[model samples]
Target chain A: MGKRPDRRESFVVRLYVADREATAVRAIANLEALCREFLPSGCELEIIDILREPQRGLDDSIMVTPTLIKLAPPPVRRIFGDLSNRGRLLDALGLTGLELSPPRP
Target chain B: MARKNQKEREPRLAKAQTGIDGVDEITGGGLPRGRTTLLAGPAGSGKTVLALQTLVNGARRFDEPGIFVAFEEGFQQVAANAASFGWEIPSLVQKRGRRSPRLAFVDGRLSPGAVQAGTFDLSGLLAAVEFRAKEIGAKRIVFDGIDVLLVMLNDPRVERGEMCRIHDLLERAGVAGVVTMSTAGLEPPGSFMLSLSDCIIQLTHRLAERASIRGFRVVKYRGSAFIANEFPFAIASQGIEVADFGTRPKYRVFTERVSSGIPRLDHMLAGGYFRGSTVLVTGMPGTAKTTLAGAFVAAACARGERALYISLDEQPAEILRNLASVSIRLERYVRSRLLEIYADHPQETSPEEQFVRMRQRIRAHRPSTLVIDPISAAIRMGGQSTVLGVAERLLAMAKSEGITTLWTSLYQGSEEAMEATPLHVSTVADTWIHLSYRAGRGERNRSLTVIKSRGTGHSHQVRELILDDRGVDLADVYTVGGEALMGTARWEGERAEVATQRDVEAEEARKRRELEILAAEIRAQTEGLERRRESLAAEMRLLDQSITLRERNESRRQQEVRARRGGEPASRAGRRKGRSAPTED
Candidate 1:
């Protein structure tokens, strides 16, 4: 196996969304906010527009738009539905114990 | 008002031929073009295969490019599964030409990370389909197991909305598409896809009569006509073939005749069965039904025409042996490839499967004649309606191909059953020959009766069937006092007639001998009288001689003695008188 890359560099995240759609826009903004706030060490993020690159979406087995996938850092995690609930999104991403904002009441 | 009239005008929907053998026949021309058709069925009901085959056949046959989007199975799996039927999917998809049809497959099967952190619609699926269709200029599309993807969305509202969106997208793209949905408990009671699609075809599989039968029906078709009855379909080695009664082939009347292999039977049928006609030979057990069918097969093969015999009750070897006893030699024809006998147990497969296999064999063999030995066994495999459907399709196929067919039906001896006709096969059959046992005259005799023969004159008399080493033989019906006599009874009648004729001749000969004896007696009596008269005449002659001598003496005496003459003359006179009397006598 190849040498383990840097922690933040190894983590590759991709978010699939339809181009210019309302939920897709919100999902991208929310994902960006989550990455910036949680993964302060920086994480590789790629946004795929299903409308523009449908083949990529099909290849990735994306049934719905605005689907998030953590490709690297082992034990890949997935979250669905625009990532609106920050706590649930973090929990689904396996980042619950990581340094981040406290849960809202 | 003119603009409103133009808006209100109904646009005629274009039809897209599915290119499947019987599907397009059931769906009018095909599903309404540039619209969505919902194909819902349980797993293993061939929903995926049906959709994929439409695309495959469209690409191969009609020069219509198509896109196949699979949500459950992978593209490779689909291609490999189709490869068994000799449908090369991967190559077909890869092949491209300037104007030739093309095939594109989009695998929409979800992985573990497929759905994550996103509020998504069916845009991804729609985009993939549209992009591929556009890339290949496809005019047909298929979404296989799309309901699985919808179910994964975990919201009925999203599923309904997604179904509507997909319908609109397919219609706007102007590509005729078929969408397959899985209905194994994941489907809600009231289906969203069924309501949104322009046409909905439901496929169902059930176990009946100890076998699994698959069926499909067009639940709804908007702005078009379709077959509503649930038609039986089979997933054969090639693909799904539905037995659709709506598109039943109309066959022209064939005037030619085919022999039934029995000369007397041919005579009974007025020169055999009409070409392309269905002949039902019904009888009780031990009536040689199969043997009669064997004769038909033998005749077909003898005429240098191919024959197919489906032996459901007996194995091919057993049938050959049994037929051989009756001098119907099918072994040589089988060896010569002029005849093919397919032997299968009725309980081994469903009636639908048997029908499909039979059709496949027919297509492969293209026989001029087909025979089903004891079709009663096949009828027993399913409900009356199901079996009738199978039988009807078989008969239709045979008729359409102008193949003479003979089906043997076993009928128990009952007035109602025999009169009513078992399974209504009598109606479908062009000619029906009923055979039964005559248990009279202290022996069992087989009788063959032509119950009904259409389009030609047939003998109504029941012929006594005599089966020997020379095959089936029909004897002239013998009736005494309006009662048909057979076996010992007929022989007894003939014997009695012969005896009566002999008795009359003997009595006449005795009377003639008595008359000859009486004539001999009368002649003997007459001969005796004649003999007496002759004797008397002889005596008289002798007497006359004597009298003449006496008279002479008397005269001499008279001369001699004059004095004594008186006494002598008197004696002489007496003597003369006596002599004269003798002479006159």
Candidate 2:
């Protein structure tokens, strides 16, 4: 949780994971797609593998893998799990509205 | 024989001592090492305090670094809450010199009001704890209030998975772990949570008789023997302490007698109280309980021994002043450092704190004699019934240290209730002296009876206590006509007895004087009669002499007449003699 931002601050998000595992890959892809769709101004995404940089996980107070942390807002927030819950995930990231296209079968 | 030998050679499960006072003893040596212990209890049941205290003890006493993952409380809040306990936790969390922090707190609380997303694993929590454990080289960790975090997860399946992850991570790190869960009633968490751990400790704090009573139970301990009964516990100033934790120490026995300060009371006890034995003095209020205790302290101090008087309800100044009125002066002993009086208000603090404070003083002073005046007044205040636990510990400690102690307790109701001492500490006392108020003749009189004195003969008589400016003394109280003669009745009885004895002596004197007068009168009468008889005998002797003279004269005359005128003279003499002859005839 680095800088406090103004009202127009871009969402600088970081995802903590243990290497590029399947769950981590899924969370990364889902978060990037959601950010590109909603954050037209700008969005910065940082990936951290806890296996290599575990201290970062402690500094961020991460309790689960594939954790998404929106750190650049005035008040930083954390979302847990593998990003499978798109509706609640969007709600947690302050990107609620605008129903996306139907999921591919 | 070979199988037995192999069994003996096999290694036993290693244990990591939590260093909590009673926890280690109950678990046979704390939780299993490199394994998890499931701690379940209701809210406000001291679960969090127990967990945090374990971590603190591990860090301070065992030199084991510990991590506390606070789920319900933040780092600063936890530290602030624990500061009142006099533990140096805040300083321990900071780096000192070249050594790593002995204890560290990690906030595992999820963002407030953040509804649970679809599904989530505890990789983030696990990773954070593991990272901190490695950084501090922690050998012990406690996820305090884990139920708060789990309830938010909202799914039993996910909760089970997360608990397993925590267990596995701690096992891999070779760290002793404690996961605390909130329970309702007697029901613990899901079976999976219970089955996954090597130990289970259940704690409960509930109200009994409008007072809180905390309980501790070790449900199961794998690969170890443990005491299975539930024990009363308390969240004292130091931490949680279980009642009846250690082997109840055998009371110290001694043959030497020490005075009870009252010489007659000593005589009633044969040779005073046995040294190193606890003595209980029970009485109603205004029965001079403190005076008896003061007398004991004064006696001990006079013998050049140290004494500690713990007055749970009275101040030292007031105690000294009151004792002075009874002529048992203790100020000199206090000034000489031979006696120390600890004044405390049991109402102001829990019995656990009271016990700890007393024990600390006893250890510091090492007094050979101790007096807890009217322990009943404060032993069971309007709070937890932990006083019995405290009483046991205090008494056991006193016995082990060979301290001769005297405790006074207040008794109400009738004679039947006299045997029931508050906290039942009388059972452990070697001697009990009960003081009662015998009301009669419109007056109340204080009397003392020796209820029991083990290993020594004691008087069964109830002696009336006389309190005045001359100090305390026991007066013999006698029963007359089925009533104990006391006060004015005793004085009247004594006076009446003296008067009866005086009257009996007066009557005896009168009878003795009359007999002496009768003997004198009989002696005078016999003397008068003897004198008269002597006089009559003298008169008869004189008459005989005269008659003999006359007869000689008459015979001479007759002889002359007969010579001169023979016949004529003889006739004349015959005539004179005739009358005499007639008379003779």
Candidate 3:
């Protein structure tokens, strides 16, 4: 169930990959940067490498590698391939007009 | 994790036993163990089924756990499909009570809209297989339609690399693997992947003259000898059964005799047909072939032995009705389970498929006798080679099981060759009865001829085939002027012989009566002659007596004359002469 977080403005995203393949590494890094820039202190990210945990990928019906799904802020959206398209990811996450928050230690 | 180095412990020469009907024999045992075996075939050729069945059979028979990775179908769909063959996939895959699961299925089907462009691999599928194999301690794994997953990559390099990785993964896991690949047309799957596998099997389906034939070949087997021919197979209700045409079955020669349902016919066949021998009843159309077969089956059932009658032209009810016309009631036997009638249209399936079904039926019913009425219809399903192949196998199967089999074949041509039968089964059959029609005497008459009866004396003369409500009866060969007679001609010939015999007998009786009358007339004439003689004798005696009296009187006169004057003697002599003359008259 992709439900909205309770009592707080939260960001939840899941990134699927196959071990440390280049596209998977790039997708993880790009997704982390986007979460750090957009959701600041309240962002939660769960990265799943199919190689390590294929059952979870099967449960999520993940067919492609380096797939990202935004599971919060009301509606859920998915992006396939490398997560290098920052604008499309932002638009998919419904953060079109959101400002970048300062990085937290 | 106490995981051992499975690669180091693998047996290089060991093979995984495929519990299919004939696959193990074809592969000289089974596929190379703990290695990848590629199963390639066209769609609907039973590639997925063969792979899945191998896994199921392995788990069930060999006590080996298995994992199934479906790349084209979901786990639920696969389970549902397997259910048709009576394989309880759910129970095999899930744990209930304290019993551990022997099988696991992973659905790897891709969604319609799901697409990837960046780096990707089948590592996820590998991980799923490995995890499940570890959980259940599986020794066998099946990848149903791995080509589907391979096609998804769209990159040849990655696909190749992933294929190698999967091979390596299976090798390291020390589990036997069957990777099924679906192909189109005749060209096989990727040669690289094929070369990398330990063994390769190819399955194909082709339709020939209204028959759909499924065949498989063991293309290559590493470190083992195998049968490399393309063997036809069928997907029966009990899964797949491969037909090995090359195997020469061993048969026991049974000495017991069985009645042919016709006492006279059995007399023609010595005592009766040999118990484990094959009887072929060949004839033209409307020659009572089915009726003859029915008679044999009925007789078998009467003997209290199970009988199976497979009719390709008529349904079971129709066969029963037709059999009843000949006073052969099979319903009682059927109801009592001593007789089983399996009737289906010859056009319903290929000859091979029909044979497979028959094999299954035989296994289930364990019939002591089998009758295939009009086997020509079944032989017509395929070409000459196929027909011959099926015939050989069928006869061998029946003989090996000591089943007395009867088959009727129809010859449609005008010329009659008693020695040559359809499907060329005459060579292997123990007895052959040929029925034909003679277009003479203004009516077509059926004649039965025993072409060949091995190890027994048979009647050489063609007898008249009479089929009636009383059952099949072969009339004694009625011949006239060196030609065997039939129908009205036969009846006429028989009548003429009887009439001739009656004429000879009547003529002899009349001659005897005339001789008796002639002897009586001769006797009467003899008696009349004797009576005449007696009367004549009486007359003669009377005359003599008269003469004697005259003489005496004459003498007395003479004496009186002498006294008077000697003149009476002359008068006496004259009286004597007169008496004599009267007596003579």
Tell me, by TM-score, which candidate is best.
1
**Per-residue accuracy of model 3 over B334-368 as CA lDDT, tens digit each:** 99999999985767788887888888888889999
Tens-digit lDDT string for candidate 2 (B1-585): 998866664346677887776778888888877888888888888888888888888888899899999888898788876776667788889987888899988878876644344455667677777887898999999988877777767788778878888889889989888888888844544467788888899998776444566778999887778888777676776777664566666665788998889998998999898888889888888888888898888889999999999988889999999999999999999999989999888876666557767877898889999998767856556442466667767888898888999998887778896665446477888898888898978999999999888987778888898899898888877667767888988876666666567777999999999988888888877887788888888888998999999899788867855554565567776776665555434
Screening candidate 3 with a backbone cut-off below 3 angstroms (N, C-alpha, C), the clashing residue pairs are none
Q: After superposition, how far is residue B382 of candidate 3 from its true place, in Å?
A: 4.3
Q: What is the C-alpha lDDT of each candidate?
A: 0.80, 0.79, 0.80
Order of candidates by DockQ, top first? 1, 2, 3
Instruction: Report the alpha-carbon TM-score of model 1 versus the true structure.
Output: 0.79
Ordered from best to worst lDDT, the candidate numbers read 1, 3, 2
Compute the lDDT of residue B189 as modeled in candidate 3. 39
Q: Candidate 1 on B358-405: residue-level lDDT in tens?
A: 888898999989998877887667776777778888999999999899
Instruction: Give the Å error, residue A101, model 3.
Output: 18
TM-score for every candidate vs. truth?
A: 0.79, 0.78, 0.77
At residue B274, what lDDT does model 3 achieve?
A: 93
Q: Which residue pairs in model 2 clash with each other?
A: A62-B124, A63-B123, A63-B124, A63-B125, A64-B123, A64-B124, A64-B125, A65-B124
TM-score (C-alpha, index-matched) for candidate 2: 0.78
